[model samples]
Every structure is written in C-alpha cells, then in structure tokens.
Target: MSQGDERGYGGNEPAGHTDDAYSTLGGTRQTRTRLPRGGDEGDGYGRRPARNSRSLIMVVGVVVLLIAAIAFANQGGGGDTSGNGAEKATDAAGAGPTAATGTKPVQGRNGTIASGFAHDEQGAQSAAANYAVALGSAEMFDKTQRDGILDAVIAPASVEKFRTTLDKAYSIGFFRNVGLNDDGTAPAGFTFVSRTTPIGTKTTRASADQTTVEVWCSGLIGLAGEGSTKPVTDGWFTITMELQWVDGDWKALTHSQKDGPAPVGGDNRASSADEIAGAVNGFGGFTYAR
Candidate 1:
C-alpha cells in the first residue's frame, strides 16, 4: 500500500448530533476517502499530472515576476521616488534567513498548557497556537481537566464566563454521539481520540498589550476500537485568538474558529482500529512554537 493510503482515520458525526463539542465548534468534516490500497493514486499525483503541472507553472511564473520586480527596483536608475522606501524594500528583499531570535519559546506552563510567552509578536502567535491545541484535545471533555485548561489559557477575568460557556457546550448528547459516555469516557475495549495539530500561525494585529492571531490547524477526532460506529477522522480549521498581555504572560481574551485553509487530501492507506489506538497512546503531543 502507498504511504498516503495508510495516513488518516476518521468518521462523520452521527445523525441528529449537535455541534456542541469543541471539535465541532467552528468546523465541519468534509467527505474523504478512507484508506485506500495504493499511494499517490488517490492524491492526484500518479495519473493526474496535468492540473498539478499547470499549478506548478503558475507558481513559477509568479516567482519569476517577483524576481524581475526586485531586480528592477535594485537598478536604482530612474522613477525612484522617496529613495528611502526603495532602500528599505531592497534591504528586506536582500535579507536572508538569520540565527534564532534567542527567545525561549515558553517560560512556564499553566498545567499542561505552555504559558509565559514573551511580550512580542512571535510570542503571541506561539501562545495562541498552543492554546488552540489544548482546547481541542480530549482533555477538554473531562470537567476537571477542562476547567484547568480554561483557567490556564483564559484571562482571569474571563475564566468564569468561559468555563460556564464550555460546560454547556460539551453536553451528554455530544459525548454519546462521539462514542463516549456521558462522562466522556470511552466504552470498555475502545479508545476515544480528539487531538488538534497546528499547521502554522499568522498575526493579523499586534500591539504592546494585545495581539490577534490566527492558527491554521488540522485535527483528528472520533473513536477508535472494534465495532465502533464512528471512527477517528481528520479535519482542517483556523482558530482566531485575541490575546491580552497580562502579568508578564499572554492569555486569551476571546477566541473564534472557522473552517480551514485545508489542503488536498493525500493517498495514504488508512490504518486499522488497533493501529490508530496504539499510535495515539504511544505518541505524545507537542508544545508548539512559531
């Protein structure tokens, strides 16, 4: 089997299911093929090269135009108004990758969530991405852990409101629909999965005391076990977090999510239920950084 055929595992939300669970807060699953037998074939890479070829050509064309523009700007002969702008642009264009900024990714943690980000753009982005992961994890299904997450990630003043709101969101019906018990525990002999992985982050606004960041993410959510009606599945989404710099750290003022800047699915084969469960148990999540 190809690598793509063995990659993702997921199932759709059950009928009549409410979108109160954190995983369904701002995104909906799109139909995707289960693990297939061959690689690259399902990913539009093996036999369908014409469309991708055209895309590649377009990308190359854009790059050539950008290079030409930069070169023309560098000529510095005529039509150069406000030489300072051109000089700045030239410096930016010429600048190459540099050494690390020397900032520690996280100074501490609020429970399992990373905290104490530096008061800067990179730090804010990092904080937002990490917080998104925490909020989207299986831990949020449990009351105690969920409260801890809220307290750890939310601003102190907003903690109570956020807690109350989430409490109502993860209802009993929501748990049952995902193959979990009312208390959010999987049935005997089964493993429930909910995990979010951030692909990247972008800062839309930043200031001394507040910053807004959007985290593009992909996630796995559902149940993995024998005879499970809902299997673990994948989704793509973007979460927008408004953060406030407080007490030498960043905390969430508010957050909202939207459906993805998702990529085309690959042709990986789907793993078995046991394989999905084992991998989830074996691998640990990460503390994201920008």
Candidate 2:
C-alpha cells in the first residue's frame, strides 16, 4: 500500500471478521450455525443478533480500539510514521549555517538600521541580510526614508543609481495596487505592512575588501484593515548583494532579488485584520544579523 493510504485492522475492508472465517470449524469438517428468523426481524437473511450486555461490551471494545488506532496513526505511527519525516523536515527548513563561533550578530547601527558590520565573510553576510530588510521595508515607500536607507546601505558609487531604480519601482500604480495612497501612505483606517525577514545568509564569494552574499528571506506586504481588497500575504525570495568593504563598513555595490528557497507553510490560523494591525503596530522590526 502507498504510504498515504489509510490503514486499519483489515486491508480495504470493514473492521470486522470476514464471512470466510466461519467457513470451517475443525480439520476437514465444516459447520454452520443458524439462527431462526422472526417473520419481520430479518433483512432478507437470518434474524439479526439481539442486543445484549456481552454484545455491547464487544462493540465498545472495538470502538475503543479503532479510536486508539486512529489517534496513533494521525500522530504519525504505523506505516505512516512521520517522526523521522518531521526531523528531516526540520533539518531541511534551516537555510544557512547552523554552528555558532561566538560571533556577534551585529557590530553597530546607522540610525535605526544596522551598520558597522565586521569586515569579514560573516560580517559581509550579516550586512547583506540586514540591508535586504531595510530595502524591503515600508520605509522604502517614502522618498526621504528610502534615500536615507540607500545612503546608509548602498556603496557611495552606487547610491544614485539604486535610488533612481527603486523610485521607479515604487510608482504610484504600485502603491495603489498594494492599497497604499499615491504618496505611499496607508488609507485612513488601514495599516500598510511591508516587511522582510531574512531566514539565513551565505557568503558566496569573499575577499579582503569585497564579498557577495545570498540572503534567503520571507516577506509580508499589503494592507490590514476591514474590507481591504489586498490583505497582507507572505512570500519567499532570495537576494544577492555584492558588497565592498569601504570606510570601515560593508556597503552594497549592487543587489538583485529572485524567488524562493521557501519552506512548506504551517497550519497556523490566519489572524483577523484587527489583530494583524494591532500586532504590526505593537511590535517593532529588528536589525537582523547572521
């Protein structure tokens, strides 16, 4: 049987003894037990067994066994074991390095964003991951905030180009599509949500003064409000950033994004708009590091 197939005491049959089990009673001898039928008691066969205390006990026993079996199976027992499967899944879910060498997650911050990362491979990876968050944040919607982020994270030589490209990307139509105003503000009763959470980071190439890092991330965007057509949703993507260690810090020379190293979604219930809005407002974002 396939692993996904449901298994019971019987193979694709009802959970009871088969008719053939009564075909013979002794070696080379066959016997049949018959019960007389009341004219109206039978349903086109011998009269059905009358209900009794012993029969009731047997019925209860079968029901209890079935219930226990089903519970065990659902918990990944029997041929459908998921204990190992779950462990494998957990291992697969982790994206980047697992061991820690006592390195600090961040060296310092530039205003609200992280800055002054260590000038090593781990530092470059950390810088890239944190930069991805800053670039993908709701702050990127406004011109001034976006410029500030670009100045802090992008290499000085690449700042102007990055700003111009991002300005075009966050156009009026894009804002409207995400339920934000042309000016990138949320509607009167709505809260705009644009957040990027980096899952892990890898230093693809590294040198004394330059490095390339890949950051696997999941993001949430849209509006949270009553009757909002565009509800906040999550998506996974990866960002590649080439960094230059300049002026005692790593800065982005160029960056690009592509889709997924996404993990399977969980069964958590979707929160309501009010709850989502409240949560977003109550909690603040972090300056992440590897």
TM-score of each: 0.68, 0.65
Residue 112 error for model 2, in Å? 0.7
Among all windows of 10 consecutive residues in model 1, the one with the lowest summed lDDT is: 80-89
Could you give candidate 1's per-residue lDDT for residues 141-172 as a string of tens digits?
A: 79999889888888776677676556655566
The C-alpha local distance difference test score for the whole of candidate 1 amounts to 0.61
Clashes of each: 13, 0
For candidate 2, write residues 33-121 as lDDT tens digits. Answer: 22223344532333332333232222222222222221222222112122122212123244456345477867678988898888777
Where in model 2 is the C-alpha error above 4 Å?
A: 1-96
* Candidate 2 lDDT: 0.60
Pairs in clash, predicted candidate 2: none
